[model samples]
Target: MQQTIAAPQRDLRPLLALVATAAIGVFAWLAVSTEFGHSLAAYDPAVTTWTVRMRHGLVTAVAWPLTHLGGTLGLTLLTLAVCALLLLRGRREHALVLAGAMIGSSSLTVLLKLVFARSRPAASLLLGEPASSWAFPSGHAFNTGVFAGVLAGFVLFSTTAPARKVLAAAAACAAIVLVGLSRIYLAYHWLTDVLAGWSIALAWLCVVGVIVLTVRRRPRMLPAGGGPRAPAAGSGRPRDQA
Candidate 1:
């Protein structure tokens, strides 16, 4: 009995670490984001000033697509497509986990926006960016972080090829960074809003990821006698060698 519990504890060490890290991130964001009516990441109007000032043709072109990709239709299609692919590959549970992670992040983003009711920067502050809604947490940054985190989890666990893993990780990380930066630069969200989004989604992924791992790693229950199941007659396999 003790051994059974011990085994699960060992298997859950990774999850414990992830949870600890996420707790710290959540606490830090909540502390910083709710202080004195502005967050450390967006304490200065100059931060927005400089970001708006950096707008140009090439950067705008690159940022437009990324923001769109993290948009409503784009994010929905991307999530469905990835979930569909995972289902096709017979990794049904992983597919579900992936879908749930992204969906949950998206849902929470909307809920938090409603709760905080933090308005975006003034229209006059906008250079070429769009800000037509609440801005406590950038939905794009939050959803993109979950997408990247879940995709990276799948890649790291499902594939063994070093090059493929590296490529996928790089792509996932790049997408997340670009999406967050786009939100900030486009003036769609404050810098702290993006940071809070990232923090929230990251904490969410770690939690969901732990649940999935726990389910997957559950050890098979043994027989009542505390031993492997005996093989059927004539099977020719040792019963104790399970």
Candidate 2:
């Protein structure tokens, strides 16, 4: 029964990979357009103004810490802690994957920033100064998107209970959305920047995930062209395996 359920999923991985590749290409073109003065994302300033206007003391209080939580230092600590927990729980593969994903996210952010060299908003409403980073894609939003998606994928794959899966998915989504909102509300990023961050993260995660799962499921072959090993004589009949 499990094989019946899983086979179709395996078959769909190539399709997923293709979709992810196409998304990455589209986003790359969008980024290039923004960088070369083609300026496809003209609404960025208006969205920034709107968010600034809607800000309040109470909301700022909430958004202030939320933004930090999605920042590099904060997310770094969280990722290390989660990696430790995963190791202690004997989930080495999961820990490695999570750490790799975060490292990739951070590296990608830096590379994109350098390539685009896009400037941040003129000012940050919260700090009264612009953040000292290139801002076409919000690093906070990008990092949080990857973090949320990886954790949610782990939970979904590890659990069989419907309610648990739903809860895990919801929590991950909430975290991603709140972090993105905090960036916009604090005037740290334009709406288009945050959207681009999320779009790229989603595309990257989907491609990496499909590749990892497919590779992990490949059947191991015996050396020297040997066939499947026979069951031990006293164990059981070979036909009983099925």
Candidate 3:
């Protein structure tokens, strides 16, 4: 009888890279097309309707606070604080991957905004003055999408339990959708802008996810007998596993 050892699965990094590249191509095409312009023009009526609807009711009041809460720098700092905790808890690889995803996605959004030079919605429904920026891709939508998607990916990939994975995925979906809605309600971005932002952000997130999976699939060698142990609790050697 022959003995067999199961081979580890191949990494999904290449697949993610391919998806990310494809998404970029699609976003580039949309940015350059007259259709995107036409779409923006066509959406004005709908935007007005939605904006008015959002300005009233208890739901609007509730969503208002939560949406702006996510938009604040303090919330961003809190997220970073959590990432720091993950690193301290020996999840440095996950932390680095998430950090890269957030930073890289943000850079791409900025570059696209400058390159497209798209304008924001004419109407300002929100309490304060509107932001000044090229607005084809809504930054709030993009950032929220990337943050939620990457966090979900990390949770799904790292956790062994199925229920937790489902919860994380649900949370991600809710966050992305809510953020996109908030942008439209506030009249900060056109509908097409939010859609484009979401499409591109999701595509980039999938790419990053593939990369993470690919990295995780590779075999790592440990020293004989698990090598020297950490001298203190939570003081294990930090390796670039991801």
Error of 2 at 128 (Å): 5.1
The collision pairs in model 1 are none
1-242 in candidate 3: lDDT tens per residue?
Answer: 32333356665667778877887776666665524555444765577567766586665666666566556363477569868998899989878887788778778878988877877766545544677777778777887788888778877777469999999999988888887877777677777777788879978898777766766655666645565544565778565466
* Model 1 misplaced stretches (Cα beyond 4 Å): 1-31, 38-44, 127-132, 221-242
Ranking of all candidate structures by their TM-score, best first = 2, 1, 3
TM-score of 1: 0.80
| Model 3: lDDT of residue 55 | 83
lDDT of 3 at 120: 75
**Whole-model Cα lDDT of every candidate shown, in order:** 0.77, 0.81, 0.73
Supply candidate 3's per-residue lDDT for 217: 59
Error of 1 at 140 (Å): 0.7
* Tens digits of lDDT, candidate 1, 1-242: 42242243446548656774976577466645654555575464677788888789899889889998987788999989988988999979878887888778878878888888877776776646455668878889889888888888778776479888888889988998899888778777777777777777777777886777677677766545676456689999865644
If both were scored by lDDT, which would come out higher, candidate 1 or candidate 3?
1
| C-alpha root-mean-square deviation, candidate 2 | 4.8
Q: What's each prediction's TM-score?
A: 0.80, 0.84, 0.76
